[model samples]
Target: MMVWTNILVPVLGTASDAQPLSVAKALAAPFDATISVVFASPSASGLFNWAYEGGFGVTDVAVAAIQEETERGRARCGELLTALDYPKTSFETVTADDWLGLRSATRLADVVVWERSAAGGHGFFASAFQQILLDERRPAFIADRPPDVGGTIAVAWDGGREASRALRRSVPLLKKADRVVLLTVPHAMARPCDGARAVLYLDDQGVRASTDVVHTHGDASPAILDAVRKMDANILVAGAFGHPRLQRFIFGGTTQYLLESLVRPALFLSH
Candidate 1:
C-alpha cells in the first residue's frame, strides 16, 4: 500500500483558509499520518531593506507582522483541529525561512494539500503547486473546501507513465474507497491493459475497482467530469501532464480543464 507518513500543508499566514487543513486532516485520518504544517511566510530581509532612511525600517515592521502572523497561524491550527474533532490527528509546525525553504518543505512531503484558484500566477502557493508537479513529481491534493473521506474515487487512466504514477500514488486512498472507478476514454481493447493493471494492483490491496471506458468525441475532460458526477465520486485522482519544454500548465488539456473547472470535492493530482 502507498504510505503517506507525512502529509504537508504549507500555509501563507494566519489569513490562510482552513479548507486545506481540513482536507489534509481528512486525508490523513485513515492512515493516522502526521499533518506537517509549514508556514511559508515571506522573509522580511529578502523583501525589505533593513537599512532605510527612516528610523523605523520596513524590515522591522515586516518582521513584527510575520511573527504575529505565525503566532496566529499556530493558534488557528489548534482551533481547526478542535473544530474538525480529529483528536487522533498528530501534527507539527515548521517555519520556512524563504521561498526556497518553502519549496524544500514541499518537496519532502508525501502529498501536499493546496487551494485551487482561478487567479493563476507564480505566487507562493502557485509556485509550490507547479514545482510539486513539474519539479518534484509529487501528488498535490487540491480542494476548495473540506474533502469527504471514504467515498468513491475516480482515476483518469491513459496508459501513460504519468497516469500510472498517479494510480500508484493514490493506492492508499483507493484502499479506503468504497468504490474505485477507472474512468477512461474508448480504447481499442475491451478493457485497456493499463486500467486492468491498476485494477489488479488494487485487487491485491482489497480495493475492487471497475473500469469504465466512455465514448467522447471531443475533449476528454468534460466527459471525465460527467463521469465524476455520475459516479458520485468524492475525489478524482489524475496525472498532471504538461508540455515537455514549457514551464507552464497545458493550455488545452485535461489537467488545465480540471484545474480551472473542478470546484466541489477534491482533486488528487500527481505528475
Candidate 2:
C-alpha cells in the first residue's frame, strides 16, 4: 500500500479553512502523517484587478489598503493555527508569489486537502485547488464535512489511466476502510474493463473490494452519487478529469458534475 507521510492544507485566511484543517488532522492520524498548513495570500495582480473592477482605480491608497487586508489575513491564519494546537503540524506563510509558492509546496506533499467551498468558483483558492490536481498531478481530498475515514469508501472506476491512478493513490485510505466498493458504469466509461480486474487488483493490495455496476443512459455523476448515497459511503475516490489550457483548466463533464453536486461524501481525487 502507498504510504502518505505529508499532507498539505493551503488556507486562504478564512473561517472555511478550519474545516479542511480538521479533516486533514483526521486523515493524517491513520498514517502518522505530518500536516503542513500554509497561508496563501491572493496575488497582487488579482487584487489589483478586483480593485479596478470595483471602480477603485489602481492608486497608491488602494494598493496600501489591499496590502493591509493581506496582513490581516495572515494574522487570522496565525490565530487559527494557534487554536488548532496540532503537534505534528507546521505553519508557513506564502506571500509575494501565489501560484509558484503553492506549486512548490504541492510538489512536496503526498496529498493536498481543502474544504468543498475552496474547490468551487474561479477565485484564487479554487484555481489553486485545480492546479494542485491537474498541474501538479497530486492527489487531493475535497471535504464537504469531516470524513469518516474508517467507514465505507466508494471508488469510481472506468478503466482509464486517470481512474487507475486515482485507485492506486487511494490504496492507503482503502486499506483502513471498513468496506470498499468499486462502482463502474459501462456505458459511460472511456476505456471499459472487467470489474473483476479491479476487484483482483484491490485484493492483491490486501484491500478486499466488491464491484457494483450501474446502468446509466446519460450523465454518470447522478448514478454514481446515487450508489454512493445508497451505500452510505463517507468518501468517494475518483479520477479528476481536467486539462490545463491557455492558463485555465477545463473540467470534464462527470468531474464538473460531481464537484457541483457533492453534498454528503467527500471526494478523494487525483488527475
Candidate 3:
C-alpha cells in the first residue's frame, strides 16, 4: 500500500497563536503519526554584541552574546509547542544563514503551511523564510477567515509556470476530493491554454483532472471567488505570487485580494 506521507509544515517562531495553533490541531486531528513538524530557527539577528566592555574591543563579546541568544531562542520554540502535537517528532531548526533553517527540512514534508499574509516588517529576521519556502515548490496551505476546507475543492488555473506549480502541489490533495473543479480566467480576449502544460504534467503523473474556463469580465479574484461559491467549493487552490517588500501594499494583486477575503481553508503556492 502506498503510504500517503502525512504532512510537513514550516513554522516560524513568529507565527500568530491562531494560525500556528490551528495548524498543529489540523495535523494532529487526522494524521499525527505521519506528520513531522519543522520550525525554521534562523538566527533572526546578526551575531554581535556592542556593550562597552573593559575596552573598545566589544565586537567579540557581542558576537558571543548573540550566539547565546539564538541558541536559547531555538530551545524556547520547542518548549512552546503543545505536548501532544509531536512529542517525539524532532523539530528541524534551520539557522538564519541558510535555506530556511541552516538545513533543508522541506524535503521531509509533502505539504507546507504558510500564512496568507506575512506577519512581520523591516528588521524582522525570519521573514526571508517566506520566499525561500515558497520557492521550494512544495504544496503550501494558507489560512484565511471562515475556514471552509472540509467541503468543495476549487482550483484556479491559468496554466503558466505559476499555475503549473500550484496544480502540481494540489494533486496530492486532489485524490481525496469529493469533487474537484478546475476554473480558469484566461487573459482578456485570449483563449484558455487548455491548461495544456499543467494538465499534461499531471497526466504524466496520473492525476485525475477536469477543466472549465469561464469567459468573464473583471479581475481574477472576484471571478474565481464567484466560481468558488457557484461550484460550492469550500476549499480553494491557486498559485500565489509574493514579492518581499519591506512592506506590501497590495490592494490589487489577485493573490493578495484572495488572501484578504478567503474565509474558507485554501491552499496557495507562490510562483
Candidate 4:
C-alpha cells in the first residue's frame, strides 16, 4: 500500500489551476497531505521561439519583455495560492528550466495533479503531463473537475504491470472511497483472473471492492466510460500505457482515448 505524504500541483498561472488545486485539497483531506504548488514558467528560449513565430525578432527588448511576463506569471501563481489558503501547502516558483524543475519536484511527491485540459495540445503543460507519466513513471491525477474523493472509485484492471502499479499506488485513495469497483474487459486481459485478484488485493488493503467485467467489441474506451457513468464513479484509476519510439513517447490507443475524452471521470493514472 502507498501512502501519499506530499502532493504536487503544478500551475501555469491560469484559472484552470483551481480545479486541480481543489482536487489536491480533497485528496489530501483523508491523509493530511501537504500540497506543493509550483509555478512552472516557460523557458526563455521557448518564449522567444513563440515570439519569433509571432513576427517578433529576438532582441534585447523582446527578451526583457519575456522576463517581465515570466515574473508576472509567477506573481499571479503566488496570488492564486494565497487565495486558496490551504493550510498544509507550500508555494515555489520554477523558472529557467520548467521541465527540470518539475521533474525534481515530482520526484519528491507521491502523486502529481494537473488540470485535465492540460493533458492535450502541444503546450508546456501537455509535455509535462506526458513526461511525468512516461519518463518519470509517477502517478498523476488529472482532474476534469473538483473530484469527490470519498465517492465511488473505479479501477481499470487488465493484470498488466502498469495496471498493478496503478492499483498499488492508488491504494490510499481507494481505502478512502465510499465504494470501489474493479472493471475488467476479459478479451483484453492476458490473464482473466486478474480482476478477482485485484479484488482480493484491495480487500487486503482494507478497501472493499466489487468486480464488474465489461464486454466490448471494438475500442474499450466507450465501454469503460459507459460503465463508469452508469456506476456514477467520481474517479477512474488506470495505468497509462505507452512506449518510447525514436526518443518520443507515444501513448497506447486506450490511454490516448481516455486522455482525449472530453466528458469522463477524473483519471488517476500511473505508468
Against the true structure, whose lDDT is highest?
Answer: 2
Off by over 4 Å in 2: 43-64, 96-98, 242-253
Give the per-residue Cα lDDT of candidate 1 at 10. 73
* lDDT of model 3, residue 175: 53
Tell me the tens digit of each residue's lDDT in model 4 across 39-141.
8876678878777899977888878887888788878887777877778998887753648788877888889997766665345588788777778888988
lDDT of 3 by residue, 100-194 (tens): 45225665566655555542212332354355545555555666543333456777776555556667666655555666677766643234466
What TM-score does model 1 achieve against the real structure?
0.81
Model 1's C-alpha root-mean-square deviation from the true structure amounts to: 4.1
lDDT value for model 1? 0.70
Candidate 2 clashes between residue pairs 3 or more apart in a chain or in different chains: none
- Ten contiguous residues minimizing lDDT sum, candidate 2: 243-252
Specify the poorest-scoring 10-residue window by lDDT in model 1. 245-254
Worst 10 residues of 3 by lDDT: 244-253
Count clashing pairs, candidate 1: 0
| C-alpha lDDT of residue 24 in model 1 | 85
RMSD of 3: 5.5
